[model samples]
Target chain A: MEAQTIVQPEKKKSNQDVIIIKHLNKSFGSNKVLVDFNINLEKDENLVVMGKSGSGKSVLIKCIIGLLEPDSGTIEIFGRNIPDLDRNELDEIRAKVGFLFQGNALYDSMTVRQNLEFPLRRHWMNVNQPEVNKLVQEALDDVGLKHTINMMPAELSGGMRKRIALARTLILKPEIILYDEPTTGLDPGTAKEIIELIVAIQKKYRSSSLIISHDMNCVRLAADRVVMLIDGRCYAEGTYDSLKKSGDPKIKDLIE
Target chain B: MALPVKTTDFLQETGGISVFTGRFFKEAFKPRYEISEFLRQCFVIGYRSLPLIGLTGFIMGLVLTMQLRPSLIEYGVESQLPAMVGIAIVREIGPVITALIFAGKIGSSIGAELGSMKVTEQIDAMEVSGTNPFKYLVVTRVAASTLMLPILVMISDAISLFGSYIGVNINGITSFPLFYTQVFNNLGFSDVLPAFVKSFFFGFAVGIISCYKGFYSNKGTEGVGQSANSSVVISSITIFVIDLIAVQITNVLNLN
Candidate 1:
């Protein structure tokens, strides 16, 4: 008989939705830090979160990164729920995400080169020294700080430190970058430079970015979509122009 | 007024203690080694504490020798005084007293630094960068303490013996060589080893606990003071507790 069994090809799933957070809640004793928080990020999108200082913007990002657990919520990243993952699994997820901390959080003791080299060495052991050097150089170049690669964090200016931190974040070529107050203490000019760098890097790398900032200028310059957090929930989210035109008092206050 | 004040103080103390312990363990194994930061901590913990440890050890030996002189003269066994005091200092007093001083200086500083970092979101920053702040900050610190404290104790013990020699000469005509011989002859491996081993735990406890207090500190400026205070208190108490347990275990083992 010439009859043969039919064969079917398996379809590859799309990772177009990078992050999905739903009904996230967190509390400390009687104080609720995050409540009914929900956010979704598409692949290669730049989302800026803006809020008052204590309005839980940082807390929300921390929860997504698995640094702090939610009281009740689901955080799905790359089609995997974080809370259910074991330590190794969580670590594996974390390796694909980069974070640029507000204070530039560079290791005070290590040279900038070592700081950039550290994560690469840890996660990609098969990477040789020349490859690491080339990658570090590329990252530094992207931040316009290639010359600072050999300097210690203590030796750099605040702006240099921030750039170095950015370089460190870029070293791993992460699929997602989360920035916690990237321009908080910088001078206005330096802040603008950093914001531009953030936008440029995100565009170049095609990585999804979630930037948490109180600075309106940063939100304006870097955000493709702005999510205004207030009272532990997302009060408004749209393009920056739409947020400005919404006439919502809280959004007005944040923009003005 | 006193009731509220007392309650507040108790809460402050308890909160500080809990935060310190929590952070230390949390960050102990995270990666991105801060070698310079670790060295700076060592300098503060090991190098700076040396003067205080040395002075305290010296006084302890001298005072013990002076106090024992009258009793020794009564028994016509004044020559045995050096050995007794030497054993006492190296076996128990040296490590304990040095650790207490270490607790005061190194423990408090670590607690305060880490606490301030926690307050300012530095540790949080470390986490975002894909660096394990625990391994870099806590493990290196604990390791430094474990390694350096024993060396510091050894130096302190030596200085104390010299001080005892000086104290003995103040009353009687005992040469340096004679005093040295007497001290060594009386000290068996049992006396030295147990004391030496105890200090590693002492160092570990001081480092781990102080870091624990500091790393978890919250509540802005208030958390800083809490970190310093709790580090000192817990490390001091733990030194004694560990010492007691070590002694009991050593005695049991030696008995067989």
Candidate 2:
């Protein structure tokens, strides 16, 4: 029951690319993190990017969110270059792109319910309170944490915190979700449950995702297509099986 | 490497802070204000600090009055004790002391809170969730400190004056009404207005410095401690610096 074999038939054109990065280049004081990198994320697809530690996986996600500026490249989300957009414009696009951090980045001071409400309050100021409560509950229920809404992030276990963070991301109804190391710190069983939830949410919302992870279980289960990042560039890209079966030592080193 | 390079680096750091301040200005005025969060911060930074500020103010006034009594008695000016202490406390000591206490308490709290958020990626998560963490966290907290410090200082001044009256009574029989009359008789617009005006700046300085330190914190767990420690140190120094400039301006304007 390989997870890659369960992916459905694709239906998309070149114009349906939700995210496209062309010749991306980023450097930090001679530490070149990305160079001559290009990637396209299609609509309604789960694309997992696998890289070793310090291999620029998180940097790529930050560039997409406009948190990091690339030196010489265009990251076009719905055909708008991320680096060229001003802060306000970047904020506008950020509403459409949800990012799940590795650490579950929930606000420590806020309750789970308040965390979910924050996105709605920011983007849809005119929406009334009843509607907000409804949406907040809906997002929480989606992650099976509706009962924990009133709890502070500290009160929740590690896995619950991660789910709460996911619920916060989902509350915005984003068209694309970017996950960074989605299963890094959790127990194996908890990590598998999170992987299942990731897939379930993607199917339920029909949202495309760009997941950056080194966890093989997550990549194997959640990826419709896998991209290998090595030397700050996309070393290979294909279905998990195609790369897993390849003779490239690097790919073998990763998937095997 | 070189002296010029070191100077340039310092300039670059200053420019970065300037840009961050500009961003706060730009984002704070836009629509979708976090009124509730702002109020919450007011409660946290202002209401919660009441006891500490009050305690310090009382002690400051009592000690100053006790120490000044021997010298005043020797000069045959013991009767002017209330007037002198009232003018000194209202005009300078009260606000500056209250702000230093605030920088110690609220400044460190903000720095540590936001620095922890930064290290754990909560700030980035907020940005991705379409929420302006600056508005929700930085602007609200800064605005609260800027607006609340003056109020806190006013309360501290009143409490301090009461403590001074008690201190005066400890040495001799100065009735409450008489003591209050002496205090009010010597106070004028010049004594009160400038101190109130300068308090706003003190609050904003502490708020912004702490936010700046925390927002740009780096490394990991160690960075959180550094942010908190530096925030207090910088904010304390900034309060004194602001007080110096404020005193100079007031003196030149004949507001002393």
Candidate 3:
């Protein structure tokens, strides 16, 4: 297929919109992964993007976070396109965004406290040790993992590791958080607890979140709005209940 | 005619590593350097590799001295053993052997560590936490390796000389002062400087190539293993290539 390229106009700062992805297209060789994909994440919104494996959900999130460069598109955060920003500008934008990976992505060599303290030290260089300790304690307390501060990631159970990862992300006091399969490998009980924790954090922080997940339980529990990704585009967008009630075979196929 | 697939792959990989090295240079000089992380990496890459490097150096020196003893005795040059062994170790064998061992241990570890971090999305998490993953991870590691290798080579050379001293005393008694005096008297500035200078390149090769392999790692757990394996292979090869270049440069400059 011939590729079409279009430059998007710069977006204005919007109090409601935390992130905006417009005409996002990413291809590896001839295999197009995201074609004209668009989405908006509103402030204080828990927006879940759901898709089957290899459906480009992860790519979309990566694009938003500037981890992956889209072939032609604009990912707007704070009125700036992510792909167009310089390192300093991008870093500034990133200070307000947090990301959680499927594998928990804890710094394996570091203790839990160090992991949580990493972002603070990186982003806020002037932060004192006492403040760092307090923030780390608070972040761990948010995830109910404060007791595991001195323990290495290798010693933590999968659930505990996930919690630590969450705490690390939360330590930055981000305005937006992105989660990629946060409960993919956990037991049902653990998954439920993680989903509940995600919900609680969203409410407590009032931060917008973009969660990429396929777990129906996660969708039901954590997503206030759901975007169905299919064939490199957003096939449908609605509240979780509305999408669940749809009679469309594609939607049914997904929920089932 | 189309090139062989392997040749094309090799070319592509070389180009990628060059670009990665270029990026390392660009990010390395930017502000907000990761000082603590760099120091941590130095400790991990330098101090931690000491025991293995020391053991290898000792064995290399002893083996070389013992092997050369018979030849020297036959030539009626047995008394010159200390000078010959010192020159050989300082000029070539010490740097090359220590670098090879470094490639095996540090290269593989850095590759696997960063590769697993990439696959698990920790690197992405770092980026999202307002940190430059390249600066915080790659630049620190590359710089640490580049800086620490020379010190390591110096230490290894000293240890190797001690080993040679011990080997000298094994059958015939050579006073410690006499052995060290002979070693020092025979070694010139040219001999020591080139080898010392080349070690930085060896360390850079190991650092950059391994980080390149790991930073772009894909596929999953299997990819992590491949990154670790190929990092050592490529870094070992690159170390030899750099050594050859250093030798040529030294020769042209009449430094050898």
Candidate 4:
């Protein structure tokens, strides 16, 4: 199971929190997704929110990124409340935050080079062509996909597409990255490669991460801490090993 | 005393579209414009559509002339054929027909593209990466459509007239100069200006409605097709509605 060496020191007293979600609540009609859920993303570590299907993990990330507004509570990123910020204000904060979608939502019609260049050219309008080329090349190199620069997303394999999508996210050199199931829909081997890449990128950039994943292997390999999401609430919070060792029935059910 | 549930749903839908439109305009005029993306969209939306529009326009003029010839000959006013057909094609038929074709082609493309992007989270990716998806996606598309459709209509009108000239020569001897002279003589500033003005509205209508349908498309894989279908239906209806209003305005202004 490769379990023993996966846990990190729970040094809660020192790390600065990069993201704070307090009393978060969201509902669609009668379907309550998140109810008074709370968690903090500490600086320079991966915080994984572990949940099963339909457990509102995606909704929580969307709320953090201001894609979906929560019914109540505050999502503060770097001290600014996301929902309360104006478009310009939110956009400014977003420049420092990158999000990787679960499905690797790369632009289908665009080439890998163009997809990587999208965020760079979009946020900084005055950037010239040479600079854009450098950034694109570097981002592609980071994901070990430099040869795919001209290839369209459709031409890439699932794993290659995921790498390209990550390259696109990395082009901006964001300080924080939110990953929505970065390893979902991958073969175990491919998933392990993705987890390693995630960890490598996080270390290279020194970026804080809030990841939503159901794969315990992924949580073990990438998460510095794990938050268990059960029935729209934060049921438990600790390192992977701590959660696995818990005597509580719900936490035990998930870990076992 | 209260409005029906369907009525309330209709109002909410209208309000959602209005808000979306307003947000589009607000972001459209802001800084950090995506020039390359805009130009690329123009190439895709405008240039790629030219051949189809030209062929359709040619057929429209030829068939219309052929159909009207029998009636004109019955009244012994067959000599007036070029002028009558020119007016019909220039002032209403060409613009509306080209727009309908554009709606079917470009409108559906935009809807399907954006809808898939929405479902897949590319739009959200853009937002999280500090790019305004509304600005980068919606504004560029709407502006390109607004600008390109008029040019397409003008080209289509010219091609349609050429087709009509060929139709005229099929059964009678008429020089190109004489046929074209007759067309231009009947087409005054009143005819050209109103038609030209309305093409912009039609373009804007198609772009906005398609974007609205696509941008908010939901319910997963099925929604992509629904978005494209609904985009065509709504944009088609909107072009006609805009045409109706433009006609009334032209009448009131004594332009026809």
Candidate 5:
């Protein structure tokens, strides 16, 4: 079945753009992952980057978070160029940015409470034990898994582990959150719950989020704007409804 | 000009390890020492390996004494058993054996651990949380192993001497004080210092190489296994090479 065609509206520019990338290029030897990819995430907006497996969605997110360096171009986060920042400066930028891994990379050796407390202890070195405990409790409470505080990550189920990882990310109260395939491996029901939680958390925290996912449901439910990454570039971008009505075969391929 | 694939891979691996070691040195001395984490690693990498190191040391001492008794009896030097065993264990055998055992237990463990973290993006998550994963994970572990191996060697030497005493009593009687006196009398500063110094290098080789392999590991679960396996192999070989160099250096210095 062919979807009806529609013109996507021009995106309104905002002075509150929290993250801006321009002509970014990243390659692993001869394999170019991101080529001249450009995107901007505005304040308190949920921007989803959708791409197929091996299409560099993770790499893009990694580059933004300083996990992977770009071959060229600028990643301007909060008026600072990421590649140009020194170690200490980069760390300062990172403190304000939270990331959720597809695998829920909770430290296997740490208890849930410890996991939540890691960032707080690291970034807020002067925070007292009582404050640390309270922050840990609050973060876990945000994820609705306060009961799992003392349990090691191994003891938690897959969904619970994801919640704990999210809680850890939340504990920092970061200004920006980058989610790499947030719902990649969960069952449909669990995936829906996570999506809902992400939406709720975004609303509560009002933090800008750059989410990388190929999950259409995740894009539909969680994305305020969606960028389609293809051929190592920003293939297309629009609201989910606008893109769903796009006649471009590439856009149709993803929406369907 | 193109190098053979294997040659290129070997060159890449070597270069990567060297760079990683250099980075460890750089990050290690920087501010924000992970003292508590380093202590935890010391307990894990040093204290936890005790039973295995102890068992092996005991067996090595007992077996060495028994083996030397037959050979020494022919030369009528059987009474010098304690001194010979002591010198052998303290000067060369103790450090090398404990290090090899450490490589087996700790090297593979660090490699698998960091490999899994890389794959799961926990390491990335740490960076996004404003923590230097290298400082937090690598520096702490490498520093712990480097500092702890010498201590482990010392304890292993003591245990081996005790085992040697038991071996001495198996055939004939020797008072504990006399046996220890004979052992200590034969041991000089040269024997102890050189042996002690080399253990740090051994630990460093294991820690740095394993971390290098795991930190850059790819290909998911298989990569984790490969990282673990390669860590042990490379660390064992490096230990022998280092021992050879230490022996040569000691000889040059006339420490023998």
Candidate 6:
């Protein structure tokens, strides 16, 4: 018998039409949070959302992930309206989109390995133990924390914890990564390191990303396109230099 | 002004019930255990609360012994006072009173911590990271409570009996060995097991409901306080409800 290579068709299909949010609106009782929010992400594009706190930056991404229900709007990921999907369907959507929480919200009880392995076990049943282990190690390597896999989240420094959280996001090979304030409280040097990691991961995985942050340095480092959220809407949309020089008072204040 | 008060009261009541029932199933099997966080919770829920539970149990035993001494004398069965009070403490009063104390001390703290985390978007961070906060936060705390409270109750029961022994000797002449023998003679597997089992449910209820209130809290700073208050209130009510059901079932089995 002649030696032959088996080709995988599913792996070749591109995750191009990733996420689309249209005219989404949300309110808490009478206080409106997101008002007519719209955005579309192409494959492997890094879109950064900049806004003051409470401007619904997190809420908008949450709606995309189907964590929050927008009162009236359509969120279509890969051409499927997400809000219409049931719980199982939403879980499927979530599996493909990795999120790094603002606080690096690592589970405090589990070791770093357990934390990284948790989603893999829950969502990837076909993956056996050895394969899971290899993937986890690889993820840790990518985040430069391969040595700290057994350590608990509490034992890690702020940057190390953030890196572990990133490793966790990579474990599932997600196509879209949403970062919520990836560098909010870290020292300037550590924040810069996180920003570098974000860019490296985006390029390495060729993954589409939507980052919600107020950190201008991070915005400049990681954003291919920046969208400023103000008053429950996209206030300005442009590249970093364009946004910086736009001369709009609010945009200027945010940049300066 | 009147309408807002009515609305607030209505929300408080309905939210309590909704949170209790919703958290019961949600926390039962969620993935991602927060170990260090849970231990910290245990320290708060089990260790720190020990003093309060201990004080109450001791006083309960002493007061019950004193109050019943007169009545037992009236029946000319003053010699049986130790055994009667011991059985009461071991069989029902011990677990119930200790659990009530647990609810007040631990339940409210869980509620407040979770509520503050929720208000601050920490819970949302967990959910967005492909981790189920319900499983991580609620399950571990509830499970810890389920495991810890029974142990706590057992310890409390022993201490209370000791206190009762001292109370008996305050006015009469009963040796320590005789006091314990009388107490144990009236207590069987029937009395001890059912009371102990019911406490697990009480602990589970307290942990789950408190976590649910705190995890889903939305109104900001005031919501944290509301969650803490409701956790204690609802868990206390649930303890009684479970006790009644447990008693009824125990009667049906002729086990008590």
Best by lDDT: 5
Tens-place lDDT digits, model 4, residues A1-256 = 1122223556763468889889999999999999888888888988899888899999999899888989999999999999999987988888888888999999887888878887787677688999999988888899999898888999999999999888888888888998999998999999999999999999999999888999989999998888888889988788888878778887778776
| Residue-by-residue lDDT tens digits, candidate 5, B1-256 | 9999999999998898888999999999988888888999999999999999999999999999988999999999998999999999999899999999999999999999999999977887777767788999999999999999999999999999999999999999999999999999999999999999999999999999988888988999999999999999999999999999999999999999
Q: What is the lDDT of residue B189 in candidate 3?
A: 97
Of 5 and 6, which scores higher on TM-score?
5
Off by over 4 Å in 6: A1-15, A245-253, B1-11, B22-77, B90-92, B116-122, B129-132, B135-159, B162-205, B218-230, B233-256
- Give the lDDT of residue A131 in candidate 4: 90
Name the candidate that leads on TM-score: 5
Taken over the whole model, the C-alpha lDDT of each candidate is 0.83, 0.89, 0.89, 0.89, 0.90, 0.83
Rank ordering of all candidates by DockQ, starting from the highest: 5, 4, 3, 2, 6, 1
Model 1 agreement with the true structure over A203-227: per-residue lDDT tens digits:
8998999999999899889887777
- Decide which is better by TM-score, 1 or 6: 1
**Stretches of candidate 1 exceeding 4 Å from the true structure:** A1-15, B1-77, B128-136, B143-151, B170-172, B188-197, B240-256
lDDT of 2 by residue, A1-256 (tens): 1122222325342348999989999999999999888888999989999999999999999999988888898999988999999877887888888889889888888898888888787777789999999999899899998999899998999999999989988988999999989898999999999999999999999999999999999988999888888889888888777777778788889787
* Model 4 alpha-carbon miss at residue A156, Å: 0.8
Model 4 / residue B74 / CA error / Å: 1.7
Please give the C-alpha DockQ score of model 4: 0.71
DockQ, cand. 5: 0.75
> Which residue runs does candidate 2 get wrong by more than 4 Å?
A1-15, B4-15, B30-32
Q: Give a tens-digit lDDT track for model 5, residues A198-250.
A: 99999999898999999999999998888888889888878898898778998
Local accuracy of candidate 4 as per-residue lDDT tens digits, B1-256: 9899999987887788788889878888878787887998899889999999999999999999999999999999999999999999999999999999999999999999999999998888878767778888999999999999999999999999999999998999899999999999888999999999999989988999899999999998799999999899988988899899998998899988
B126-211, model 6: which lDDT tens digit per residue?
A: 66555567776777788788888998999899888888987898998888888888888877899899988898898888887887
Best by DockQ: 5
True contacts kept of each: 0.30, 0.76, 0.88, 0.88, 0.85, 0.30
* lDDT of each residue in B1-256, candidate 3, tens digit only: 9889999999999899989989998889988788988999999999999999999999999989999999999999999999999999999999999999999999999999999999987887787777778988999999999999999999999999999999999989999999999999999999999999899999999999999999999999999999999999999998889988898998899897
Off by over 4 Å in 3: A1-15
What TM-score would each prediction reach against the true structure? Answer: 0.81, 0.92, 0.93, 0.92, 0.94, 0.76
